[model samples]
Target: MKIGLYFGTFNPIHVGHLIIANHMAENSDLEQIWMVVTPHNPLKKKNTLLDDYHRLQMVFLATESFPKIKPSDIEFKLPQPNYTVNTLAHLQEKFPQHEFALIMGEDNLNSLQKWKNYEVILQNHDIYVYPRLNSGEIDSQFINHSKIHRVGAPVIELSSTFIRESIKNNKNVVPMLPNKVWEYIDHNLFYKK
Candidate 1:
């Protein structure tokens, strides 16, 4: 089985996220996309991110209707401040039979050189790059790399930070988020001013 890891903090899983994940799952060779909920950094402070379980729950709610996309808490069990390369290695060790790939935006691709042990990641796994409205130029090296694939997925400009801010300002961000996710956020009074 080939799995595509879509990593995000998902403070609240919104529609734009689902669109990208769904597009990847439907358009790419990947059999399934795991919406990996990135654990909040214990070292950082004063962020609006929700609790790990809450964010994971939101992912579950957002992806419940999408069969090809599933929510993952794989990063939660890892130590804080983990890097992508380490996560990939850990996942490979845990599930040797499955081939793991990364699903990222072009923006992340542009900054790939700065990631820890990025060369190793490129050497071991494939990367499916989706379009982002605010991305910079993709690195020349990756432009034609064998392991790098540019996917012409739809450009979703919406972001979880925008949704959270809208909710805090008492604006209805329901349309921006999944129905169940919105309900959970509303019921829990999350991101309220």
Candidate 2:
């Protein structure tokens, strides 16, 4: 089985995240897309992040209806400040029969060089990139020798952070999240001001 690992903090799972995962599952050779919820991303801030378990539960709730989309806590048990290369290596060892691909946006594609052992990751795994709006043109030359592919998913300007802030400010967020996710957020008073 081939899997596309869509890694993110998913402080609160939202629609844009679901759309891309759905598009990937429907269009690609991938058997499923595991929303690998990172407890602590090495590249992002940690102060504002919610509890890893809580975030993971929200992801589970958001993706429960979709058979092809799964919420994973693989990184939660891994060492702190998780790195992509390490996570991929671990998953490969644990599931030797399955092939894994990296699912990310073109924005991250531009900064691939900064990731730890990025070359090893690029050389070992296939990458599926979805272009972000106005995130400058992708340089094909960088991954010329790597197995990188582009997806044709619709680009949305929405992000989890925007939805979080909206909820914090007491704004209507029905359109930004799934019904189950919105209910969970409301019940827990997540991101309350």
Candidate 3:
């Protein structure tokens, strides 16, 4: 199977993420879109992120209705402070039959070369990019690159930070989240600091 890995912290799996992943699954050549929930990096400074399992659960709840989209916790099992290149290599080793590609935003493309072993990633797999409002120009080397495919997905400007801050300030962000995810957060009283 051809899978597009959409990796993120998914702090609460908001609607922008859902829409982008769904668009990738339905519009691209990729047969499946795995919403990989990035595990917490112990080395990083503390933040308001939910526990890894909670974030993963939100992804699961948000994606449950989409047949081609599934939530994954593959990163949780990998080494800490892992680079995308390493994760790709690990996934390839484990799922030999499946062809894995990357799903990212145009903004990330601007800084793609800075990623560790980015050359290997481009050489080995395809990258499906979605639009991001006001993204910087992509690196020249990646422009018109055969390995890179720009998908005409809608431009999504919403972010998890915005949602979290909104919730913290007692603002209604229910429409920004999936029903189950909102319910879960509400029940848990997350981000209401």
Give the whole-model CA lDDT for all candidates, comma-separated. 0.92, 0.89, 0.93
TM-score per model over all chains: 0.98, 0.94, 0.98
Evaluate model 2: give its TM-score: 0.94
Candidate 3 residue-wise lDDT, 75-101, digit = tens: 999988979999999999999999999
RMSD of 3: 0.7
> What is the Å distance of residue 93 in model 3 from its true position?
0.9
Candidate 2 local lDDT, 1-193, one digit each (tens): 9999999989888999999999999999888999999886656766668888889998999999999999999999898778899999999999999999999998999888889998899889999988798877666666565488888888977888888889889999998898998998899888886
Flag clash pairs in model 2: none
Q: Count the backbone clashes (under 3 Å) in each candidate.
A: 0, 0, 0
Candidate 2 residues lying further than 4 Å off, grouped into runs, are: 41-46, 143-146
Ranked by lDDT from best down, the candidates are 3, 1, 2
- Runs with alpha carbons beyond 4 Å of true place in candidate 3: none
The CA lDDT at 100 in model 3 is 98
Residue 4 displacement in candidate 2 (angstroms): 0.1
RMSD of each: 0.8, 1.8, 0.7
